[model samples]
Target: MARFLTLLVLLLAIDRAFACKPEQHFNANFSDTADQLSGTEAGNLATWVKSLQNDYSNHDLFVISSYVKNASQPGDSAERRTKWLKDFLVAAGEDENSIVSAGTQVYKPENFFYTKITPSTLIIEFVPGCPNPCCLGANPVKEK
Candidate 1:
């Protein structure tokens, strides 16, 4: 019994360490954008978004993922990432209608700079708190 308990504790700790801090990851920084969510910084914000779709999740609460950035990339696009996020959420057994995407391109005309990043955000509503949410209605994920 002691051995089992120790193993369980160790497993739980490992999971937490790897999983993203849901609360902070979905923060309404009102300043964060998706373009800036990547890389090692931002607490690995992009990965946190991915963690929400973990199969082991069982929280009866809504999740809102917001993407932000500092500037716009002429070739930058969130469509691909957005699709991945949707797929991730569905795979995690989350309802397909809870993902909320919001943000606008940064106006950086005539700026050919990789550093000219345009922020964006992706909000996944795990347990929606809003009435008449504009996103797709929550529904069980359909196995493909």
Candidate 2:
């Protein structure tokens, strides 16, 4: 029984690490400007995030922003883009803790299996995870 239980636990761990994939929500061409999000953009983003959270009440929320490398201005960088998004989300009444700022990375659509993608586009990916209190021994269960 001990050997069988050990094997089961190992298999389950492997499955969680490899078999389970994060559900990515793409906001293609979320922005044409690398500076900041417009009022409408911020509002829409907040509304969408909130709705998703409401629906997946048990899953944690994370935000990732990918921007066009060639579109950045002389003073612009990935960090700045991330800050812009974070500020916009905060201003829109989104809990800062709930938001994860994935620092600016090259907007590579090929990595996402897209052949044609716009320049200066920002892709926001939402990944689910266990919350703080439930981190230990808690399995992520997707809501219907």
Candidate 3:
């Protein structure tokens, strides 16, 4: 019984060690224009990216942009916003290959229970390792 308990504990620890929990670093609303990040927002983003590059140099960065169809203009797209952010980060000195991005469309119901719709938002995450063991050598970035 003691040996079984020890084995169970070891298994749990191993699972936790390899778990792919991404740390959210940024979240905010972006304008319709891809490069329309405000001065303050741009400053903050640059600082965070620099810090990530300097402090956590070994980890990869994941960025996600989510937008509601009804909240954005007819021509706006989540992919454009996400790509803009990735470009901005690269220009700011972050390695282009170390960053991954995803754009997602969010659906919201119009019912009274969910009246408030979220605006177009960008989220940045820090990914430490591949989420699955099978893809250990390949660091594929998927939406979190």
Strongest candidate by lDDT? 3
Identify the superior model by lDDT, candidate 1 or candidate 2: 2
**Compared to the true structure, candidate 1 yields what TM-score?**
0.32
What tens digits encode model 2's per-residue C-alpha lDDT throughout 1-144? 999999999998777667555555656344555466667766777777677566554445657565555445442545566666667656655567877866555555567575444545566666656542223465545434
Residue 57, model 2, lDDT: 46
Question: What's the number of clashes in each of the models?
Answer: 28, 0, 0
The candidate with the higher lDDT, 2 or 3, is 3
- Please list the residue runs of candidate 3 whose C-alpha ends up more than 4 Å from where it truly belongs after superposition: 1-5, 18-22, 31-35, 71-77, 107-117, 129-144
Location of the lowest summed lDDT over 10 successive residues in candidate 1:
128-137
Model 1: per-residue Cα lDDT over 15-132, one tens digit each: 7556623232343222233433343434454455456444324444544433324344442345455555556556646566655455334434344254433234344445423221
Give TM-scores for every candidate, taking all chains together and pairing residue i with residue i.
Answer: 0.32, 0.55, 0.62
lDDT of each: 0.44, 0.60, 0.62
Ranking by TM-score: 3, 2, 1
Report residue 61 deviation for candidate 3 (angstroms).
4.1
Q: Is candidate 1 or candidate 2 better by TM-score?
A: 2
TM-score of 3: 0.62
Q: Residue by residue across 71-99, what tens digits does model 3's lDDT show?
A: 45442566666777888877987678867
